[model samples]
Target: MEAGEPTSLQIEKQSLHDQVASRIRDLIIEGHLEPGSRIDEAKLVEQLGVSRTPFREALRTLAAEGLIVIRPARGSMVRKLSRADVFSMLEVLAEMERLAGRTACERASDSEIAHARDLHERMLEYYRSGERMPYYKLNQEFHTFIASLSRNETLCEIQGNIMARLKRIRFIGNSEPEHWRAAVDDHEEMMDALAARDGQRLGDIMAHHLSETWQRVKNVI
Candidate 1:
């Protein structure tokens, strides 16, 4: 066997768990599985056509990411982040994005910045066509790209976790026309800052952008 190779059984298990997790994640983010509601493992397993083992493994993974809560006897429920909890999460996310912006500005290669611009342009096209879902997904991709530009895997992973936790609220915000337009405008400014390699400016812009996002989602939270 080759060094560092995963056995077929291990690979199959990982694939099942990951697929289960992704399905549940989309359900949560799309609000099909409401927050604070108990997850019906039997029903979900039947509906998703998956077995109990992978379903349970997926629940554990979501719990670690703050998307689900496991209680003694009560079983697993979709986590409901309180207003305070939401704000605290946003605060940390804001700082993480600020750091990402600053670091990317300082260290991102020209090709990286160009790639970001390309993403922004594609996102703008979606916005222009009034394709809300595609625009929203591209918007997230654009931010994730910026986080990658920081060249810090730990920071990127932290950003992913927080974003995943807040994704439901974020989607609601983007569905609003006013907030959606404002978010697109912020992305434009972010691109400009990145183009100029202005770390401080990009950081400040990211902080403000996050604040606006919080405001937009405050009603839902």
Candidate 2:
């Protein structure tokens, strides 16, 4: 390698820790790392090709996020979710989303609302095309655009955390055609409420919409 040139190996190593952390987080969120399963740090370190420092750092980060529990002797384990945990999280997210939706109804400019409508239409087209991946991506974008329009940084952060935890369960629910259609309809209703600037109606709809989702996915979880 020439001077000032970044060797492939050097670049890879520099970002290896972040890569490892992201992979671990994905596994946890996807249920590949089951709740309460002991994380074998030694094996993970070997597999990730990083030293103890970065591996431990990743563990600490996850623990801080309430995704992992670090015990004195048992090392690290994935955090287990009880029914109460599920309900409590869903309730909190529902309220946060309601706040976002209400704020968006008041604060979103005409162009922003139109963009969301366009995304929704595109999402429906993707669904009709039977390409699940594209549909899911657009669905995420639709929700994210609404959240962005709320202009509440704190609410956006909270919604992101809630969505991350729910992603795995959402995948399961999306596998059912009935749930998929219902989810599309819900999005449409949400968009309608936002377009009308109906803050109270939007809040009610958002809360109920999330509640229904939790009801559908809780059994699978």
Candidate 3:
């Protein structure tokens, strides 16, 4: 074995840590652990049947992801974005997606564009089945895929960082049937614009799509 190589047990421990983190992330995003609520670490550790080490490690992971705030003496609480913060972050996201839409139209290969179309199709199927979380998962993936199509690493990196904070906001935004339909409609048009290679049209649609999220989730905080 190479010096400094992690042993198999160490790998398993890291994997367990990541699984714990993912579970916690889903709890926050799905509203099971409401925003601004303090994380009852002892209770959760027992519930998850894991020890304190992994649970605390998971908290650190989520803190880095912007999903939770860890205070020196106050323990940790879910990071709740105020209405103003929501607006500000979504504004930046909207602008970035707008640029990505434009750039993707210019840069994405035909196969890549078709692949995005396929992802949208799968997401629509989940929507048809009325599966909210599955639909949102695909919805998130589709947006990230579009951003990656820009082929600009910096843009994708910045967008991802902002998105880590806004995950719950975006997830909850489509709680209503009307809001979900509106979002789907926007995506449908976005696909059309992309297929036509109409960067201007796609950019406008993407910007409007994110801007509408504010209306859907204004009261969450």
lDDT of each: 0.84, 0.76, 0.87
TM-score of each: 0.84, 0.73, 0.90
Best by lDDT: 3
TM-score: which is higher, 1 or 3?
3
lDDT of 1 by residue, 102-122 (tens): 999998999988999999999
Give the residue spans of candidate 2 off by over 4 A.
Answer: 1-16, 49-51, 114-145
Off by over 4 Å in 1: 1-15, 129-133
The TM-score obtained by model 1 is 0.84
Candidate ranking under lDDT, highest first, comes to 3, 1, 2
Number of colliding residue pairs in each model: 0, 0, 0
- The digit string of per-residue lDDT tens for model 2 on 61-166 reads 7776677888987799988777677788889988987888889998999999899889988998987887665786677677767888899998888887777655
Candidates' RMSD to native: 8.2, 7.3, 7.8
Better by TM-score, candidate 3 or 2: 3
Name every residue pair that clashes in candidate 3: none
Q: TM-score winner among the candidates?
A: 3
